[model samples]
Target: MAVVEGLLLQATSTGLLLGALVLLLVYYLSSSFSFKEEDNEPPGPKPLPLLGNLLQLDLKQPHESLCELAKTYGSVFKVYFGPKKVVVLAGYKTVKQALVNHAEEFGEREIGKLFKNLSEEHGILFSNGENWREMRRFALTNLRDFGMGKRGSEEKIVEEIQYIVEEFGKFEGKAFDTTQPVNNAVSNIISSIVYGSRFEYSDPQFKEMVNRANENVRIGGSAPIRLYNVFPWIGPFLKSKRKLERNTEKNRKEINGIISSLQETLHPDDRRGFIDSFLVRKQSDEKSGQKNSRFNDKNLLSTVLNLFVAGTDTTGTTLRWGLLLMAKNPHIQDRVHEEIDRVIGGRQVVVEDRKNLPYTDAVIHEIQRCANIVPMSLPHVTSCDVHFNGFFIKKGTTVYPLLTSVLRDESEWESPQTFNPDHFLDKQGRFAKKDAFMPFSAGRRVCLGESLARMELFLFFTSLLQHFRFTPPPGVSKDQLDLTPVSGITLNPSPHKLCAVKRS
Candidate 1:
């Protein structure tokens, strides 16, 4: 009987231990889940399993959809693109705070699958941490050295403007799509800075390169490409993805050819342009036996590619928008024309003349604000876990600084929805600066070529206005001109023709 009692006691002890362990596990898990609930994560639309908020977003105009969501869920909110969670900072105040105030926390570039496949995080645009820092520094320094924003650059642009004027004269006031010529002209400016020389517009190779680059930009933001970003495995099935890959490969080969020619003729003392400067640095790094230098051939190729594409697309698109806007609002165009004719007369419009042309300057600023080309800016990732605006965002969460919201912020602009130059003009009618004018974006990841772009826009716009009057084709009223932008990596004007009538 005693032996039987002992066995029962042992069994009882084992059962109690097992029960205690189960209770402890339950408490720990419950506490963990409760802790997450108390984290005060940003509010967002309810996400479906696996799909997340894919159905909620408009793939074509995701920025527009997010702006609408901001109406219901405040400035700081979360949304899911598939299983990926993203925190969006909307409005001028919120965006500025997150980007400028909390820059480090919200500064890292979020490399989507498409970008990852294209860039492999090698270049300045899609890279992070040490590699990005080194490349950006080098690019900025080299670009400035090659007269990116200086008088040298001004001279290059002035020369290019004459070419553009000559090209427009070829149209002889006939209605023609300005896309190719405008893209070519703007591209040559960067080409001059990158390759140290401009290509003739008639050059087949040059035209092909420019056309391919622009096409990539157009297709990069297509619905299929957006889906590819969310579901990378579907890339092989998507035509857009395959086309992008093909275009990228061809461009890579062409770029390699150009770089090889530049490499063979590289003169250390007479570094011609950005490519020469990079090659010289690469050679120096090699001679020093530097291990893992960021100046490798891959970095050089990717960086050049990044600079070429970025330098061409945004400035070119903005210039196109300016012309289209001028065509759409002839009154605004007239004022701009009057300003240019009044301030600088028939003489060349130089960078130094910007201050004297406040009305014209205001118009340009307003163009950028209204154009809102890079509506989403580039996606940013959190460098670390962040508690921002009463919300907890974990480390590595993708963040979209909604530039569209800031550019169109109701609180910031007096007429946010309209094209109003007075938005940048004070009661005194002088050119005034608004803190919310962030067409190039803000903070650490702000555009590297901002100064260069500013110079380009002013010179290009003023010069074009001086030479020709932009108008919609015959029988197309100003009202009939559509402002609807074609979806792209940059918002582009839809297929339209305008007459660049030579000013009498």
Candidate 2:
């Protein structure tokens, strides 16, 4: 009887211990779930383990895919590019709010593996903190001094426009690809500011540099490179990455040669252009014995690379798109020509003339809107934990301000998908600027060359329209001329030809 009583006591103790453990487990789980429920992270499609949302993304056209997702998930939503978590800010209001109102919080650049590999956190585009600030300030000051948007740049652009007209005359109403000549002409504008001189269209070194730079821009947005950015371990196996590296090395060597030649003849007292000013600053820093200065050769090379690629590509791409859009929409082209002829009267178009030419100005604005280059304005990062649009975003979260959504916001544009110049025109036909016109982006990270790019677009575009009537190749109808852009770091018009019939 004593033995049976001891057994019952042991059973009772075991049951009590098990019951206490179960209650503790229940409380812990409930609290954990409650915490998650309260966190209020932006909702997204359920991410799979390890892969995240990779399977859902269209790697080639991520901006479009993300825009589509925003339809279901609203403006602020989370997405995973492989294992990397990203919060996308869509539409005009949200993007403006994040980038403008909360600039400090969303101001940092998200230097992904690809950009880090390319820039090494050295140049204005990829670097952050003091390096970015110093480089950007120096670039802006020197660019202004060297005639970025002023009379000096105007003269250079006018001179370049003549060369472009001459090139078009050679084609003589025959369909020819506008890519090379247009790129060369547009590139020379930046070339004058950077190297203090322009390259002849036939210069092998200059042509190679431009070709390589444009090629890198194209490949940098390829599927393999995008995947390599997400899964860097696969970089070694990517032909695209290898080609990019080869092109980068070749371009760097060529750039270094140019810098060396410039250095040999650089006069601190007679600064010619941007590179001269930078070298002068470097020399001064060295003479002062300043330690840990950011003005070193690496910074110089990287900064030049940043400026060269950006200056050459974005402006050239936009100009090309302008021409193509004109060919595709001859009616709009007619109005532009009419406006130019009526106001400017075949005399040389100048920066001062832009204000008088309202329709032309409106057309240019609409062109930028329709082109929508840089659809996913370079990725940004959150600088601190914050509540945005009622969603909690942690510090260091990668944020993409989807320019595509903003440019095409239904609430912002009358005809979001259609190419309509009326979008920038008032009822009385005056040039009207919209608040959502953020082609150069907004806030601290806006394009360093915004002023120059605007000047270039207006001058080059008007000059071209004045000199030539662009049309689809013989036997191709205007409606058939595809407006579909080749996806890249920037959207490029697909491979096609147009005849630049010289105006009488």
Q: Which segments of model 1 are wrong by more than 4 Å?
A: 1-38
lDDT of 2 by residue, 190-247 (tens): 8899889999999999889998899888888766666667667655445567888899
* TM-scores vs. true structure, each candidate: 0.92, 0.92
- lDDT tens digits, residues 268-387, model 1? 999889999999999999999999999988888899888888988898889889999999999999988898888888899899999999999999999999999999988999999899
Model 2, poorest ten-residue lDDT window? 8-17
Model 2 TM-score, 2 decimals: 0.92
lDDT for residue 135 in candidate 2, whole number 0-100 = 98
Index of the highest-lDDT prediction: 2
Candidate 2 runs further than 4 Å off: 1-38
Candidate 2 backbone collisions, by pair: none
